[model samples]
Target chain A: MTENKAFCSRCGVEVEPHKATCPLCGTSIQQTEEEEPTSYVKKYPDEPAVKTEKTGRTAKQKRIFIWEVVSVTLLIPLLITLFVDLIVNKTVTWSLYPISSLILAWFLISTPLLFPNILPLLYIGETLPPAIFLLVIDKIEDGQINWFLDVGLPIEAVVAVIAAIVIIGSIKIKNKGMNIAAFILFGAGLICLGIDFIVLKHTRGTFGVSWSLYVLTSTAVIGGFLLYLHYRLMKNTKLQRKLQI
Target chain B: MNSSNFPTKKTDEESNQNHIQKAPKKDWFRLDNAATVFSFVTSTRIPCMFRFYANLKKPINVAILQQALENIIDRFPYYKVNLRNGLFWSYWETNPGMPVVIEETKYPCQKMPIRKKGIFPFRVRAYYNRISVEFHHSITDGTGALIFLKSLVGEYLTLIGVVVNDWQDVFRPNQEPHYEEYEDAFKKNYQKNLPGPPRVSKAFHLPFKLEPKGVFHLTIGIMPIKQILNKSKELDVTLTEYLVAVYLEALQDILFSLPLRKQKRLLKPIRLQVPVNLRRFFSSKTMRNFSLYVTPYIDPRLGHFSFDEILKQVYHYMRVEVSDRYISQQIARNVRGELHPLIRLTPLFIKRLFGKIIYNGQGEFLYSGVITNLGKVSLPEPLNKEVENIQFLSAQSPVTKTGCAVNSYGEKLYINFGRIIKEAHVEKLFFRKLVKDGIKVRIETN
Candidate 1:
């Protein structure tokens, strides 16, 4: 009953409504739609260039803000626990702090999407408070590197590991990166850990330092594995090609 | 029975009877209506689609979906690994060796497209009772996914049944998953990757506590057509544009009744991530998952936007995303690259943390839903007669609490919604208005 004069884009053939493509000649043409234009851009880590440019946004600026917020907020509880650890060294074992710090950072900083609005507050709260504490701690402690060898460096290692995995993963998954800082961070943490294990354990006791070999061995294994991966990455040149964002 | 075994209808006219088959390509990657209605794009723990098959029988067997999924996953390895000692040509640019399973989600989707790991924002899931999937905006558009789903359904049918003719010319024969047809992917000339920074936003969109009112079993039958461009023009949009607007209007009415604000701030536009086909980009149709996304954000202003306006926007947006040159270049590059190069090397623990890094706060607008219209499905009539109806439903995981799905066959459109938002007002408003607007609306409960 309806006079359908729609023609297929692939092949110039008139087709009726709801007809997928031309019948006389098979051609893939678009279905007709007269809908409103979408001004909203979907949030994707790796947005297409046209999409990114259309929105007048860059992945770099956003990352700096997010990292500034998240990384800072994540530093808070660590400082708090550190602040708490200094006063009550006899009461609480120092070793437990890094584990707790890891927990707090992973749950608090890592997965803020689970808790929506409180996220920004969590960021601001994490930032200003910690900056003040670090200032005070710097004045109180003697310039000796004991804290660095003990609670301080371990906590840093945990933070670095968490940051690296998250940053690298985000870059790979979301398609934005400059996690060169994160790489240095995690790499430094790993190096620190190796140093702390070898030197601190030897300094602490002759017998206990034997366990450092195990740590060294594990690090070598991980390093070797990374080498294998780097080789594979070189072998597999697929990751180099980026989709037109 | 094989392709040769399909029944030759007495005439092309008889075969092309409003066969209720889904049109192909455009809107093939479109998703359900509920996917559009909500503001949050959902993700899952990755194991939901996996079900240990117990009694693998005829209908509702987990094996059908599982085997199909597994078969698809298994097919790419031969291409990924340079097995033939370089005797077989290797396209190193868009190699199949890229990790399809992301580190954190390990979601088994989208190995081809160089984007996020999981088909987050949207994906497809197959269950024992049903199969559902939600894909992000990076994959194919709705129309494209629909065509693929039909192909999947046809392949499923082929797996289950032996096609035959009235004269018994078609005979029983085992169908082998011949991946040989796809072996030459790397040798293709159209190889290149679009270079762009990842799109992340500063604004945060929160999920309005909504649940699936009910799961609607839209028994969509396919019409005999190579693709469904005809109906789209009649509807005045691309196939996805039309269906999405239909559902969006339906959702606006429903959300309007929910005692909510007049103008909400969290208008995380309903992002329509449709899959675009790269077959035109490919030298052959033998490759697996040769699709990408044409994502468009729908303004959830409800009744403010007309169907005509929405279509105009969605159609052009999609066209630009999946333009012929873009599709072919992506395919060429993908075929050239190697698979799982970095990811295969990364430890699982580190990989789990990867999603958090990239997705944590890269973008502002939250994705509302994903629609993949696999396009029209024209099975050999002999095979079509046996199918009561083929449905594609993703695992309705509790991750995001709401999702949408769509599959259409010619005149009949299936807008199956999977959500936990217990609001019927949206469904009621949609069904009523659809019929009022002359769309033959049908409702089914399964």
Candidate 2:
């Protein structure tokens, strides 16, 4: 049999015959013709046999399982509460609010976790459940469809619009932090003003912007400052230093 | 769900609109047969990837390498696309952003960072004196990726004032991305009118344990070219056939020693999947996936097979399978399945389910292991002088558990064996077998 090539003792692997130093770690090594092989031959170490568990779940699947377990666990309590309340009251009573709110919470949490890609659709999908749940709670409590169609629906619509604006803006402008801030502040200001108008119409019988003026003034000022900062950062060297962090 | 408010899937159109500032019509494209399998089979657990690396004489400049990577991206727009969901087939759409480049890590060919959708399907990493490019097999085959890596290095050398000429041998930067480069070569050359090749049954597999973190073991053996060539000549077979025969011998040795019942289950056939680059047989220069495989095997049920017998068998099968008619028939087999009327009508989710099943149940079971020979990698003179060695490593298959890739440069041939199992039984036996043949073997590990 021919001679085995020289190996780097530091690396515990063979190196090129011409190498004076290890290619991986620049350490000096010397090999002679009669050197014994330092590496293993027929057998590998028995301590670390590769893990052979075939049916182990992946990280994402594990996360999904945990979420499923949490949902099921929460469902049991909700079901117990509903059964107890229905049996005692003989009608849908105080349990209606908690059940509707729990379902609304589930939709909000699960939509972002599950269907994260299509945000616009998710924003719309998330809005309908909460608005409908509010209507359900309202009908059970007062036996009337009064404030839901007027105030709750409008507020949800505005919130959905603001969510869409933020999602689209963040997706479009990758590095424009100030632009995203300004867009969110501006959308939030408009949404606040719209909500105030809807509430004022319900309370005072007319569309008059009451508490919204203060929100509009503060949000407009902050939004304007953010826009100015964004433009100034685009033109100055100081922005680069801040961005490097 | 309200259909009016929810936007239609406009990925291609939206990408074009942002780049050109005009609303363009949707430009969805279908996944080719080779690419289709990868789309559904890829998870964080089992990503299909292969990596190639070049060792330089001096340390690599990260800045210049990153610049080279960015410059080369415009030329490979076929690889610059993002995956999208389609009605019956997953597709690719234009990626209007640059591909990511980073420094290499301790892990060489790990599962590609494909968890995030819309990320590029390839990555360029540099560390120490080595520059490695790993590609998702969905994006391109070895030949195509090798061309890209060579061109990127060539561009880097030129930028650093190395006296390099004739990038004409490889794909040069600033060349317009051609439609032909991305064309599904299998589809274009498919003989729909001809009959398909004979179907394959389940093949043998190794009952090896795998690493928990999905980590793989890579052992690269460097041997002199002349020693192997002389042995091949003496045996009257090609170098690949000689190597395949040796690999077969190692498997047979393991097979006969196993308990009788276990042997009966695992000893159906010892098949080696030799990926045949189609560029040699066909005249197409497309950089997309265009390679096919021929499984050359030995049925243990046919009694004992000596090394020489295995060599002759591999030599004959390679000769028959590498021919144009047989390769075309194989292509017809794959194309016919895709062109099936019922398959065409299947929904995307259902198709993905079938694709996953086919990948795990069919793709993995049909081959015991894979051996891919990149032939030889040569650079222009000054650059070649700067580069010391080249290496290629493929991810270990979940089923096969090990794979072998070969790359040669100068007088050195590098055989990289990647396996998920901790024990290096096959590699140790193969190298020992080489040493027994009077060939000097130098081994490296990662």
Candidate 3:
């Protein structure tokens, strides 16, 4: 079978037999007498005309739906406790604890679901909830936040700062490998020292050190060894040559 | 399924069976140097896949094609593996399942769901009169894919009662695969301590709006091979150099057509990434990604360049860059990067996170566009008569927006442009220039 062809009068290039206009310049093609449109087969098949049905919920929609369900589920217990406390004691006295805990739970769960790609928001979600929960408990028990300020917030701040350093350092490092472990180890050592300092100050009303020194020494040694291996031993050209694939 | 009906001799079949049973199965393979980047950067937008197809004179028979695929798959044992994730890097594990032949999709080079369990890195697809193989770049490059396609078409033709006597480059189904065919040639030829090629400045990108995800536009321009070759001969340059010069001129036209302020703002070098097949330089038979690219650029800031000037630049640039010494420097750089202790020790997850940044910074950011030519394709005697033409389609890149693949079969030279952008300015300009230069072009789009 012979294939029929058409050329664009303006462009002087052959167009597909089925096309009425040139694909390049959109100029109309003058069909010849011998050209039969239906005689030629398309080189590639056309896209299916029937659009496939959208049957399932999108990922974002599903995440939002789950968050709504969790919110409602958490809300039910909070509402029940609030009503019971009001009915028995004529105020939101005992319900505050459950209410605060439920709010903290919702914040933690929704943080990942809503701001999953936003790292700073997720970090805030992780660090802020416990501090708020502890402050609320401190106020509820003693009508002040002295312990929350001296021990709770300080310890949380130390952990958050160290965790941030490790995470950001890991991302920023040019060649990320054993050095990440070293960063984590060093961060852990700092956290131990921070915890010891805060607890000692809060308990004994003086600044001093304790068991954390041993922990700090051990972590520093390991962390230093990892650093040495990563920077010194691994970077050696001779070693790399020996290990080359 | 009849043994006597097949091409493999009875003795060869017995030996192949024995080899399979006696050989220790390599359950896993490390990603080659070129493939390591693809493994990390490949996603739905950038599938990192390419397609090579052959158009036969007759409609394809699905059952016979399936049999042909099964018969020939063992000869390409490396391609039969599936992608698996390891601690330090991604690997290819032996996949025991057979790749089923499926009907061709409306689109070409769609993302292979390789991360899914049991999914092979390459797929065989058949359409009305065409049979295609889409391979993830991790599995092979264009040369390897072309070899695989030729073999498959040969096998298919043979099953359909055509005698294929010329199996010079074609891997027959009955033949045993050589160990060298599966070796990583990049690692094998790497020379340490050599300086890498000079760093390239960021090149100009097409100012076209990206199409939606999963949308790839293909425009193919077909012309007579003799006409283009004669034109290239008149210009005193090879066909590749002629085509690249035309491509560069097209980009220059687009850049100058824009508003002056916009042109100044986008006044970067127009560098085309032309991939060089390294097997020609180094005597290696490995069927993996053993190719590097030479970026022939024209700086718009210098001055307006005529077509002749661009051709001169591309011709000389290609001459100097497509040499063994220059290519070895590239291989050295790539192998060195892969062998660095920190890079080797870095966990796969962390590498994946940084891979996109690295790819953007060091990969596509350095080139304006990509044009890969597979040159002329020739099949053996009787099989050649049954085949009409062959087409190569490169994968769509979100950054570069357009890539061109060129190959010739018989008398027809097929230039396919794969784009992920809404505009077809590059395709239009490139083809119109060819038509204007007295070479007839037939256009088809998908």
Best by TM-score: 3
Runs with alpha carbons beyond 4 Å of true place in candidate 1: A1-245, B1-193, B197-208, B211-236, B252-262, B280-288, B298-303, B324-347, B354-365, B396-403, B409-411
Instruction: Give a tens-digit lDDT track for model 3, residues A53-120.
Output: 34445346777999999999999999999999999999879889999999999998999888765678
lDDT at position B181, candidate 3: 68
Best model per DockQ: 3
What does TM-score give for chain A of every model?
0.27, 0.67, 0.60
Model 2 ranges off by over 4 Å: A1-245, B1-28, B113-115
Native-contact fraction for each model?
A: 0.00, 0.12, 0.30
- CAPRI tier for the interface of model 3: incorrect
Write the residue-wise lDDT of candidate 1 on B1-446 in tens digits: 01221232333344345144412211111111111111122222211221111111233444565455444432222222211101111112222333232211212222222123322233334433333343432222333233334444444556677443331211111222233223333334434454332452332122454332222112122232323445567766766676666555554444344435633644435554454444444444332234445556555654456666766766777667666665554444343332223432333233324423333333213344445564433344555554444444333333233344555443444454444333333344444454455444434322
How far out, in Å, is residue B389 in model 2?
Answer: 2.0
- Model 2 lDDT tens row, B161-249: 88654443555564544455667888889988888777677777777776775566777888898898898899898888888888877
Which stretch of 10 consecutive residues in model 3 chain B shows the poorest summed lDDT? B1-10
Give the per-residue lDDT digits (tens) of candidate 2, residues A72-96.
8768767887998999998768887
- Writing each residue's lDDT as its tens digit, candidate 1 over A1-245 gives 33334455533333444445443234554655653332421111222222111222233455455756776666676667766876777444563445354544544444433332243454444443433333334434553444444444444445444544544553354322123223444454455455555455546753233444655566566655554544444332432221100
Per-prediction DockQ, in order? 0.03, 0.06, 0.17
Listed in order, each prediction's TM-score against the native is: 0.46, 0.64, 0.73
Q: What order do candidates take by lDDT, descending?
A: 3, 2, 1
Model 3: how far is A117 from its true place, Å? 18
Q: Which prediction has the highest lDDT against the true structure?
A: 3
